[model samples]
Target: MSSGSNSARRVASLLRPSIIDSGVCRSCQETIGRRSYATATPAATESTTTPPVVTPAYTINAGVVLSRPPQITRELEPFEKAFFFYQKRLNERLALPFTKYFYFKRGTPADEDWKKKIQERRTAARDIGKYNAYDSDAWNDELLLGAEQSEPANQVEALVQDAESTANATSQDTSKKEDIPRPYPRITEADQKNDQKSLNRLLSRTLYLLVQSKEGNWKFPTSPVETGETLRLAAERTLSESAGVNMNTWMVGYHPVGWHKFNAPRAKKGETAKPDASGSKVFFLKSRIMAGQADLSINTQNLKDFKWLAKEELPQYLNTQYYSNIKNMLADR
Candidate 1:
């Protein structure tokens, strides 16, 4: 052995066993004059995650707004009559004047006949109390100062008598009379008797179908929504079930017109509330009854009665809050 190798062996034999027995490797630990040791490191921890929240479910219902559209025009009020008359006159003034020559040639037999008819027709202003002193005969009454025996007065009286006689003779002859078709009466026997169920009652105004449940509550036909059915489909089915399939009806649209939320029924004293008694929501769809009437006998919901009523008459039959919610959906006439 060389002298250097003998010195290295002497230093290793002098080191303590405690320094060599340390957990850290020899490369990690420093070889200071006083033996040094490595410190232990802590292990990493895993992160925790939070779960998602769930929403509560609500019961959905579909309802129908079955209505009978007005067949005849609604009666006009006196004010409305005057307003329409004024508007008609204003429109007439703005309209292009009729060209007489285009329809009837000048000085022909047809033109002569037209001129005679025009002379016999009285001005509309005479009936409505409208007159222009500068344009028309402002004094509608006959001349009071003129002698009754005047030749012109006698001629006018004769002409008037001849026209009256001809009109009277035509009216008296039954076989020569024109066969003019008259309209069905606005008021029916059902209307006279106040029969609520009859569809023929109100001819002029719009009529809504209101069904009375076995509990005596009046409402539009409605039913719970079934799985796999849309709101519109549910509404269609509900109407057929509640009002019967006899009526020919058409839904207005696929979307709902309005929605009303109903609260869960309150439990009585000493009674437990049902678990699935969550409040329901009703979405209404507008529909029109084109033909046939509601037959309550075949109603699956056990509806006791029904009515075809006008919008104005609904308040008398339905509750205030319920009526107010649906008032806008109903037609005025």
Candidate 2:
């Protein structure tokens, strides 16, 4: 062949794709076709490779939202009180008349007593707003009964007397027995004295446990999560160790309720910082105390004081940031 024609054939071979051998199977040719895309270019290779991202290490801790649920119903708002009062009146109007004879046989002491009481009360079933007027005559106290000649001059005073008299009689005849049990007052001595440590205080609101550290920082009971320990188990251990074993408590669930994270404290002067210290992460688990109280006297965490405070009171004791972070997990009432 001529030198120019030989050079032209070499250039054509360089531009064309390689052909599969005629002897090769269809499958082998298909495999070879796929291998063509694997040819690497500088831009393609650089685009495909990625440097692994490194996440900073954190010291994991578990905390407990140890709380005492409300022992009594929360105080009703004015609107709520009116709503309940309306409901009670509506229910009373809808109810069938009480058949006293059916309950107590005729001519017996019970029947006689019922009749006497009914006569004394003289309150109609349809009486909605009016207080029991005749109920006041039953009381022996002359001072409460007022003078025989004198009468209440003001309409408000008369209504007040009627209401008081009705309440006294109704309270006495609430049940068949005279020895009906009365509930203890919601306000206890601990509440009056503002004793934060006492469980008896704040009976109508959920109370949380917060402890003051030796450094004067107040927070929920927390401890480092040990190797192979779950957040729940760590929280349980933290409560028992830091708050003492005197409390009777149960974890709400296995899963963590909430979490808080913060940057690690900067190393002090002359102190070598830890290589692995990046930040701190705390996972909180909820718990409820059924009985007993926290005794910090035997705790190993060097806690100075503890308080069982309601959610509204937390802002005064805890850091603003910390309170804001965990406030969603607390009971508002």
Candidate 3:
């Protein structure tokens, strides 16, 4: 054997068994006169595992300013007042053929806005293949809430102008008495007829409560239930953020009236879904405004419009089953 290899063999033979058992090897310990510092090293791959996602202790949506909770006063209980109002309205509904009575102001700018709204609704109905209201062509003074008339249609205006022209001419060439204009009501008569038709079309669909979202989609204000919060509490948060300017005026039913379950579509190739395969579930509690006026200033700051809609009226705006739930909440049946 070579001299170096011969020396290595001699040193290995002289090594004590105790030295090896103490985690020291001949090449690293005896040769260096001491053990080298060492530790168990994890594999390279073990260092690169994905970290867990951390959720916040309290959850809330972005840009949402939490409002103060409602104050219960020494006054009447909310449920009692609501029940009384409900009973009164219900009695009025049963007493008349028309379940609801609407009063409109006359000769105001609001009248024009109403007219525009009616026209818009009619156009939408036509597009959707739905019929307008009953007696849409009616022009009687009683049917118009005392406004009594509308801007006459072009055809009616043309006829009126022709009648006036006939009245202007001497009665020699045209002796037809029916075509003559004498103390007859002007364009308003024709306008009223057209307006009645428009109003009928508008009335075909019931008024629905809707809030226009930032994306321009119409939906109710909704939010996630926070930790340590009840469904009613979460619902109150949502309401105060969206519709109730005075958070103190809002009230909620203790139990959930309905729920909406949402699941995201399956991921496409090379894509991964969110951590939770089941997306989310939203429970809706029955709610009411206690004393404040309906305000569009709070939750609607970024929105265009919001309205308080009756249950049956939501069919024009919401999914069928959702509409049914709302209907059940609002009516006897």
Candidate 4:
């Protein structure tokens, strides 16, 4: 073969064809074509291309972003549709009909059977003298006296033995001689003068009754008793420091000391335990303002507000739950 032809053949062998016309190999094309008479379709000779479709990236409905198409129809089961309808109806009926129905059923008895049963039970039970009057014997005595007395008898004369006795016995229960009022405890002028020194000594030890304030969330002022200080001393100091008011007269009444106990969660074990809690003793001191004394200078920094309320109006202002103790204290005063 010529050198030019050989070079051309070698180049053709190295290059792969863009498409194959048949299943037969190019190297054994003539031999296969002769042996197999069957024909095969040829593959595509070049790359295929198609245009891309452009769809929306997003949709908006009433300013809300939507990434998918909205459904044209909602699919719900028969029972679900019925349940939704029933719920809507129930809500509407609840406004009036349901409440009325509840009250009607509660007020109206089921039948007359229950009422009949109740009446039968009541009749079967024993009759006790529950309505018997307490002063029946007294009324019988008056009636008997009326029959015996005939001295131009009036209603008053018949019921009573005499006008004085009737008035005393019925009005004031002063039938007993001891029921008469006694004279007040008297102090002679001489005794009073002699005991003036002793009275002054007793008054010096007396503590005053003062309240701090009950404003801006009511809270009682309290202070721990200092060394060598008594409970009375602590109360006096607390009142003085908080309200700037000094008390000279200690109240002569048994003041109630309210106490309470509560359980709080323990920090270490995550459990609750009872802790002792107690309230200060509230004293009812019957006191008068000292002559020429100025208005109390309240420590506004500690107490938000302060007032000296009258004893009579205290009940209306005080908490009803704590009124019992306060009332007893005031009563004693």
Q: Quantify all predictions' global Cα lDDT against the true fold.
A: 0.73, 0.75, 0.46, 0.35
| Candidate closest to the true structure, highest lDDT | 2
* Candidate 2 overall lDDT versus native: 0.75
> Model 4, range 95-191, lDDT digits (tens) per residue?
3333323434534564345444434433111111111111233122112222322222222232332333335546754545323333322233533
Best of the two (1, 3) by TM-score: 1
Runs in model 3 deviating more than 4 A are 1-208, 246-252, 268-270, 276-278, 300-302, 320-327
* Model 3 agreement with the true structure over 1-333: per-residue lDDT tens digits: 699999977776565334455576766556555544455876667567788975433333211111122222223344554454344334433444431124346556776676665554442211111222222422211212212122123224544545555464556656664453443343344245544211121222322235666666655566777678776677666776676665344344566655555454588899986555445555656554444433556553476665444344456666665455445544321
| Candidate 2: segments with Cα more than 4 A from true spot | 1-56, 94-129, 132-181, 267-277
Clashing pairs in 4: none
The collision pairs in model 2 are: none
Between candidates 2 and 4, the TM-score winner = 2
lDDT of 1 by residue, 148-207 (tens): 322333434444554554465579675563443344566789889999888887889889
Any idea what lDDT model 3 has? 0.46
Instruction: Give RMSD to native, each candidate.
Output: 16.7, 12.9, 25.3, 36.2
**Top-TM-score structure, candidate number:** 2
* Candidate 3 Cα deviation (angstroms), residue 140: 32
Q: Estimate each model's TM-score.
A: 0.59, 0.61, 0.35, 0.25
Order of models, best lDDT first:
2, 1, 3, 4
